[model samples]
Target chain A: MTERADCRASTVSYAAGMLREQLLSPTPVDLRAFLMRALRPRDCLVQVGGLAEVSYHGRAASTAEVGSYLVMIKRDGSLQIHTPKGVKPMNWQPKTDEITAVLEEEQCVLLASRRSPVELVRVTFLEVQMAQALELNEEAGFLLTGSEAQMQETLAAHPELIEPGLRVLNRELLVESGGIDLYAQDAQGRFVVVELKRGRATQDAVSQLGRYVASVQRVVGTGVVRGILAAPSITGPARKELEGRGLEFVEVNALPLVEKRTSQPSLF
Target chain B: MTERADCRASTVSYAAGMLREQLLSPTPVDLRAFLMRALRPRDCLVQVGGLAEVSYHGRAASTAEVGSYLVMIKRDGSLQIHTPKGVKPMNWQPKTDEITAVLEEEQCVLLASRRSPVELVRVTFLEVQMAQALELNEEAGFLLTGSEAQMQETLAAHPELIEPGLRVLNRELLVESGGIDLYAQDAQGRFVVVELKRGRATQDAVSQLGRYVASVQRVVGTGVVRGILAAPSITGPARKELEGRGLEFVEVNALPLVEKRTSQPSLF
Candidate 1:
């Protein structure tokens, strides 16, 4: 590899290390790009916010939804839910690019892709929303409602969804690139990047989001790429300012939930 | 000095250094204990949802104003409008407790108490608020109107109001003990404390303020101290969270120009 490529790889590795530290905490890694290399083939978006949709390659594919279940990898790398839901462990590694396609083909079905076998798990998005709502309230010990065994059952079944989101995000936002937040595709074949704010949205937050928007827009036409600020509720002044600047605000509470599939048998 | 006192002082000095670095960035500080120590003498109350209020020490005596002005000391030690503003200048040393008492009793009216013989200028609070407001909007080249110069001129003229507000703040909140922000009583004896928000009030921002409040409450009783977030319009989940906690929020269009008067001017 060229010196520049090596440098770039090192930088990515460094970022991945930092991210892993943030998630894993005490479990510090010795490798340079542990996350990038390990999670690879699976593209990961770290700390992304203001994303409207995720695109695959050059196409703005509808973001994949496994019912209402929204999975988020926290800053600490540990999985958490704003709602009460169990995340099951699975063995398959779905090809990142094909995960979206698999979700597209079935209302709730599994598919085998070049990357790995994919399974569509039955879950609800409201669970995630509920978890977020509880987070807003700062309640302690908000646990998952389903048993760990059930979550494991789901994870054992639908392993494809986890890495694909990252892959789709990588293609749309030019993953492995240095920048802020995560990248994805919007509805109109545009890149949609998101900047999350758990606190009050300040000018600094807005500007940070604005930077990500600009960066993504440069690659995807400005019109194709849009910014979505995901927050519990924006303050009046912050809302007034960002909305005035034409940034779309998607209140997570107001976000539509993909219908959960109950009758569909579990792939497990 | 007692061993405990010696240890505490060392910790204070250490904390001051850490604060200088953290507050210098646009990123707001996110510690409760640190804020409590930095804004000494004043009490702080951390409410549910991480909302905080920094109560002025002397507010128990006054009740007309909306609340204390959240002010910050810039890294240079100059006062700013945000918390964890920065470090104080190296040469700066706050007055001792004894001096504070003598000065407070004198109501800072006599020209002899103006600690430094700097020129006096008068500045309208509205303009200062405006400057802060614009800066928070990410507007470039934002300057605090010649308020500092104006304050110099005002001090030169009235000289009597040199420490007009000195009595308003409690003696405990003064810099005598190496505090970061100085909360002095204004001429009217109404409690006013400077609150600093390095950036805008996000959830982290509110958390910082919550720490400030918790610190203040430890000294002053509740219901006496009113608070003014005094930033550009606060927005996002932080706003709702702050409001939900009952801390009064004030959007100042400008900041008050504070002049360095040599001696406290006395109308007498």
Candidate 2:
């Protein structure tokens, strides 16, 4: 990394950045100590990528098959579990009440939990690959301006705007009935079906949202789903039908935003 | 990495494993060549972890904020994107029709896509972290034994057992109404609500599934989710109610399994 810079442009973000010397090959005790101290500061974004088995319990119970994954702990009390593929996080707790790590029976075990509704995400790292706590900016909320895609980006990035502790599992999710505007889990861990209408929502908007809800209801089988139509305004007819369908409505203004994120430009 | 092993247990999965060197510091041209060749072999699992901007289209449309992520492409025509935290992949396309890489604007751009239903996952690598194609055993599908947790673990690993091309995003996921047995995406790109029954799926099983479905339906506003009740057998009443709710049923056997996977034992 210290090699003299050549004419070629660097594609490496951390060009000369080396993972702390000791971190290159961290021991279990090292990992536990690093995780504890890293979580205490709550300043740097702590990331550990390696082999692990993860399990979650609370709203919906789940246990993942053994594999490698990247575990990120953010200062916002959010712990995101990410697999090597996809834009959606496999399992996540937007904000945790407590995060702790311990070396149990020779292996490093990390537990992140929240109390309100009582949710827990537990991960056991069998092998540590790279455990680096990087300085990442999460408080600089982004202002994205564009069409429905941009709105989805802004809202997805800041789910709190819709509801505190709300997490959008996936955006532009395709389901049988049609493409859903947003697929999310609520604060209480309920599946939230969101239909984002950039302008004033009227007419068929209610029915459109209803169809998507029905499709999910039939498929989700036994899971409660909440349908929400988010827009600046709603028509009386749409509002009336929405109530009959038991769907909720939230007002969202399509404010002109000044883009601030260093996001990837649209693929032409 | 060249260091000799000492008394300390090695935590690195690939301790002496170098990232094919040129891949260590890959240029746009080098990355394209590396990715294309790695994917073509369809033997070694191609993993590229670095700083990149990713977006997904088809079955759903999503654009992620600019950041770093790990991109892994498997021989199974699957592309997984991993964030720093969580067991679930941020975005994924299981069993794609084709995988390709290109150099655009002096940047390494990789695409993994499927023609059927036409889904696509595009990743623009702003910086390549580690691009290594390692030989991973996928055919050695696991055999897990135990109780309900094992059942879920088995299904999550071999989602093909439930249905081909079905990807179980997360297991034991907690939702509002109750804990979902499995959260998966169907081959057709729709959200699939799955309830696993290790024993006879009868009696109030239908009602239980119904509750979970309703929760998800209410939450997923405009998406079609297919509800599936999987178990060994079902009573006539349960079957009747399942259809009445438009929920489909699949039969699964809880046969005594012989544990074979190099799986980690339950953390005491």
Candidate 3:
């Protein structure tokens, strides 16, 4: 019989309960243990404690590999531990203070401090393959760039369409080495950074873009850096406030290549 | 000629800046303006008042269908209208005090007394589309009962797997009215409602599932209603915390119809 969507949902819930039971039972698997099980053994684990550290074969490695281990921390006392795969389970069990101490002694220093009393500790494997699969190739970089040369070429060809004194800069350096949507210079020689947003825009993106601008100003001098964003859209008021901050607002026609099919395939 | 990644990035940045300048220049045709010009005759105009409302040609149903609008209440107690799509030039400024008074007259209240003098208002289109779509499936009771039957059949074999009392009931009852995801029950007579998650797992899922539970409980009894989620997989800790509250968690196994693609597409 064709498995109906409701049936699929219920069965999935049942499977989930089974998994939960397996995880929360007395012989609970901690977040690290769960990760060791889900990810390839070679996949390194990093714990960003007071400082960042890597763990391998149950031993803390002296050095950390580039993007080797996934970092997880509970923002509040929520104590969330997101693994490369997703959330993992913590070997949390109801134990008296004495038993807890004994177990802590056995587990490791990481498990010793119950900062938030480990309300729940889970380690779900993240789809790390996606991160691994993400290749910063010429296509991604070129698309990510708000370069001057490229803009110049377009402007040169479409001179009648664009204005004069617009200078385009490529891969404009920001303080932190994180992905920037785009960075450019204005006619007045002031820098204008444009961050292109495709998916659901987060406060983090705006805040981070602000940081990039701040960083650039810190390096180049104050009042030199400005910010802008080009997306198919923005939520209520974001565009205005972003513009109000002296960040220019420019709307671009979404390139045809930025389509949904690049992400998921659907049956027609 | 090979396009250096840096070079491409620079080109993109430059293009973005040039585009921004062109859009802001004295008489430039920008995308925002182009869309506005095309849609204006449809009674659509960028709203500058606090409670932004726009009209469209087809049906000016809700606020979301209108052109995006941003209103800023500057420190000088003046209101600024940044309708980038308006026929008026960007620099063709209007009287600030007059506009502010007009906006205030239009019930344009500031976002906060002093904290934020400005707020951006956006017209959302999805809500209208969703409302219209729901109209198509008008037989609410029949649809709900049909969905319940499908859920019951799928969980019949696994009835004993979940809590002892869970079972499907009420042809007229529904788990969710939005109709975006599926829902069902467990063996314990508990109403186990399942939600299909498409995005990456975040604590937000828990809040949303909580809402689903509340909604289902409102229709059913709170004592009998339980919430569960079926995604590709949930992280260990998330699953644990959710389960700790008696909520079920499930992981889905996606397979191809051909069966041959199964091995390659497996999500283990």
Candidate 4:
């Protein structure tokens, strides 16, 4: 199902379970009010793209050269302004910064400021190609886990779950390129390099394992060295690459049930 | 200093310490090779926007409707496809997934796949508005410290750092609306609500602290309750908001030097 709305200054469309409002013209618009209305439920993403000129005044005054810019505002009021290309934004208002939006007839401006050290970013939109607000479901309690370490610890305690006679040699073995998750040996006495992922394994993991396997094989000789990718699941492309490279994949769950059980004293 | 290069199919320009490569034509171009070359050092961001139609065929076969799409590729091979207004990507390849780019006469395609689950995402560029690659500096050894928690611990250990006679009553005090980082009593015996940030405090933090202060004030009576925002630094906007609302700002460093000193064994 799809729903769409159009105002004098913008077009709002909903399709494929997403609500999007796009402003195409250079008309004067109340950006803050528009954002408040569009970002209903307070957890959407606001993206502004166009030519921008930024100036900072107070501690010291400086003007940034005009350029095409992309500004992303998170639901938490944190926002960043990025130039055409780069990993980091040229200027940013971290999540803790206060943001105020000012809309005028000629242009729209966003002010992000903090007082003690006196930092402020004044973003002036010269021409706004697009100002869009996308509705997103609030993700609940997305906890960050120390998964790789947890997986290694789990496997070390329960090596048999991986395969019979598989023995863990060491954890986090540093190689020239990167660190190997686990160094191990199988029942056949052949050296094995194990790569663990806390979640579903992807093609990059396969490639990484492949590189480590190649490096280890060079030192251990091709016939005696083997590689294994350990994760809860593997993607199709990753599995294809694994089998094609003569490597193996094992599903390893990283629940700390053993640790929990060991930490609790038995009532008996 | 700035530099620029242009080919029949694309134009590359550098200005304001940023390198920008853009392809404006409707004609087919080898986007993969262009990306591989432009993203030299392999740690840049690739953003493709305009119109996109994606098809997935492998374990499950489905085709996405043609629409304006934004595709972001990170340095670590993670990519996400977003419609103009969604917080989550319509399709995504996690960082662990392997990505391959293929350029054809009619279209430029990117394939992200995983082997075990037999998953694949084939993104076909129907119309390219803008394709850009920007250079970024390599960040070295970025450490993640639990700064907020550390700050709370530090202040609890050394309340004198914040102000004389400031006694921490409790940590993570739950209020009606939000949790106050620290609940304390000032030297004047006023109920002080503290909000702590490990890094620079922004305007949002001030707003949040205001909310907490208001909630606590209702119970303690307005004149008796006070708000204090503590962080490593404060931005101008945040400070302005702090002053406007009659709140206090305090700088707190979270190096854990005190904890380190106490944890060490005596050399004597």
Question: Per-residue lDDT of B127-190 in model 3, one digit per residue for the tens?
Answer: 0100000000011110111133343344444443333554544322343422314455655445
Backbone collision tally, model 1: 105
Our model 1 lands, by Cα RMSD against the true structure, at 31.5
lDDT of 3: 0.32
Q: What are the DockQ scores of the candidates, in order?
A: 0.01, 0.08, 0.01, 0.01
Candidate 4 clashes: the total is 30
lDDT of 4: 0.65
Report how far off residue A246 is in candidate 2 (Å). Answer: 18
Give the Cα-based TM-score of candidate 1 against the true structure. Answer: 0.21
Ranking by TM-score: 2, 4, 3, 1
Ranking by lDDT: 2, 4, 3, 1
lDDT of 2 by residue, B88-167 (tens): 55778877887889888899888878776666778988756456665433121223234567677778888888888999
Worst 10 residues of 2 chain B by lDDT: B2-11
Expressed as tens digits, the lDDT of each residue in B61-151 for candidate 4 is: 4466666666777666666666533235556665424566666556777676766655677787766655666443323222223457766
lDDT of each: 0.30, 0.68, 0.32, 0.65
Tens digits of per-residue lDDT, candidate 1, B41-157, equal 321111111111221111011011211122322111122111111121111112211111111221211010112422111111110110010000011121223233333333334
Off by over 4 Å in 1: A1-168, A171-178, A253-268, B1-268
